[model samples]
Target: DFFIEFSRQGPCILSRSILQLLYLPLFNKVFGTLNFADVLKDAAKNFIFPPVLMPKSTLLLNPQAKEYVDTFLTHCVRPFGNLVQLCGHNRARQRDKLAHLLEDFATLQDEGEWKTIEEKPPPSSPGRDSNLDLPVLSSLAQHDKRVSQLRHGGGGLDVDSYHRTGEAQCQRAERVDAYLHNLSLKSDSPRPHLACFGTWILYHTLRVMIMYLLSGFELELYSNHEYHYIFWYLYEFLYGWLVSALSRADSFLTEQEAMAEIHKGRGTKKNKSKKKKTRPYGREITIYQALQNICGGFYKVHIM
Candidate 1:
């Protein structure tokens, strides 16, 4: 009960109080005396004669449940997802536990007792063949949402959707390669419109980031319910992804130092001894603790 109460009220009270800590100079700087006795007296009085709850705020507890709620996200991630990323070149270092698990499952699925073969369409009906090509997600609401978002949104991601039989890691890499081949053309023709990247590696890096958002983010946090604004801001997530994407682009193009030109203007010189230019942000940093502050504490405190 205490834990529940703490989860409810802690966030509402702490959010406002934490902001006050930033402005503490307002009260302390002007005053000369640090009256320890008076501070203790006031605290006792307030506890005995507690005021009415504020419009949307509740009274926080002394033995506050802050710490428990604060760490709930870490708890959720261990069993479900640890926010790992997918890297094609360095598989072991980059892949998280969840990624490995899914890939393993995909592998077992290929060697399964039950086989689900896609049905062929009637030769007379061309439309039936096209319908077979249409993407189908599980009945789970989350999958439905991701598919809808992917269809409307960009960067070629349908996160919750399953892959064909293989290692999930290899499948992801294949998709990234396919995306570059189709989208990252050098010159624009009267052909279909595609999103092009400066270098082939840059496109792969972007795909990694997108895959992280799709897979890693899903692993860490649950989005089955309503709004998730408190957990992760869409703009911030994409913005951070872009930053990491560019960093990877710089490393791949400059350090690898291949003579092959990425574009007419872009340089592709080799550097035999290129130093690590900058510290690269890991996939976990951008998404970790995104929901820690808000998830469990959403209903911790109650109005009394």
Candidate 2:
């Protein structure tokens, strides 16, 4: 009963006091301090006089009084940037957790069951046949030929071909050195594309910071529904906008890189043979057509 009354009247009383403070100038000008203090004293007198409904024992042993006092103190208390510092600390913790989770997921992928299927066996076949099975055999032969052609002529592995397992540490160090050297030359060379890429990275970092702060607060202060809603709303808006902006930035960068490559004449070669041989029926009819022709040629064999 005491808790119910406190819950109902506590917020109302606090709200009225806040409104009165806001109109302090008008009250002071019109009624002066004497009338103001008298009104204030009367209000304070209500606290001294226990409620008729409130039991004497319950009034003396107020369970919610401490909470109310803490609430009042929290509202009145002023700190020099403490809230900002607290928020920063929470964001940092969240960032650390997110980083750790990503690292763990990567490690799990590297050590997972999918590694077992890295080796695959060649297809097997039984006995060979004569001219009767020529069409079927020819189709199988064509499929094999196509597979071999792709394996031998496909754009050869670039990164994996250069990657060395035993010397990975040494290779990584060399790559880092080269990267730093290129980065140092950027000021003189002025690669606008790389600058934009760096800016995009920074933008993503800020987005992560915002996400981290919101998630951290939601997890820690689950009871603060209003704060949770505000944080989530801000996070969703910022995240969506950042994602859209990043997508546009990525597309723009891709176009710039493509144009740069074109200017340098550094794109994949156009296969004239592939262009000419696109429509296969022009070159030679498929085995399926040949089989149908043979079947039609020997309708008597089908009857037998």
Candidate 3:
């Protein structure tokens, strides 16, 4: 309000008016009315007097000038300095207080200071059994046990001791046979030793025997080509055999039927009049004729 009033009148007019008001004894006397009575009623109450001394001091400091810089600085600049210092402090509590103070001062300018008070009780911790009450360890142990059980239970069938022993011996024999066979095959010439020749012949003979067993002896008899020749040969041989057997059985049945028909005298054929067969013209001639007919029709239409 003071600043607004100050701004309404030009600064020069405002300053001259304030200078004239400061020197006027009448203005001081008017303010002194309440103070004069307060002094009579109770001398202590006179201490709460209006701020008329500020302007009076400005007049004494500069009698020739209309305004003094110190009065303006004291009224405006000092509070701003206090605000800056309050804001600059490193303490959090002081900084927060200063911010609230600034907000109050900005809103309530020359009015009294705004005060805030808060009463909060100190914080206290919960009891000591909190960590032990957590279920993390128990849950982890259960998870681990479940994982271990799955690992053990998911392993495939376990062979018995006797079966494992027999399998091991068979595998060893197979490996030795393979090694000896490879060695014999790698030899430049046939050997005279009966055991060597016997082994060589046995290996190949066993291979052929196994091939026959696997292919049912059919592929060996029929096929000469080597690429899946065994499988196709075996398939063809089996199919042919089956068909031959079925045909033989069917022929026997047919013979029986024929004999029955003959015995019943129902097998004779009757002669019918014959008709000569006409050969059909080839598609090329038919197509050419169709094309000619289409062309002639098209030409006639075009001429019309």
Using TM-score as the measure, the top candidate is 2
Model 1, 177-290: lDDT tens digits are 233233323323111111111122222232333343443333444343222321232232333334444444344334323322223225656556755644233443344334
In model 1, the Cα lDDT at residue 63 comes to 23
Comparing candidate 1 with candidate 2, which one achieves the higher TM-score?
Answer: 2
Q: What is the lDDT of candidate 1?
A: 0.28
| Location of the lowest summed lDDT over 10 successive residues in candidate 3 | 110-119
Q: Candidate 2: deviation at residue 263, Å?
A: 3.2
RMSD of each: 24.8, 35.6, 58.5
Residues 1-304, candidate 3: write the lDDT tens digits: 2332343344554464454344332322213243222222131112111111222322223342223212222233333333323322323333344334433222222121111112122122111211111111111112222221111124211113212332333332233223333443444421111122112212222222222223322323222222122232223222222223223323333443444445566565733654453222233234434543544454344334
Cα lDDT for residue 187, candidate 1: 23
Q: Each model's TM-score?
A: 0.19, 0.24, 0.14
lDDT of each: 0.28, 0.30, 0.28
Cα TM-score of candidate 2: 0.24
Global fold similarity of model 1 (TM-score): 0.19
**Candidate 2 lDDT (Cα, 0 to 1):** 0.30
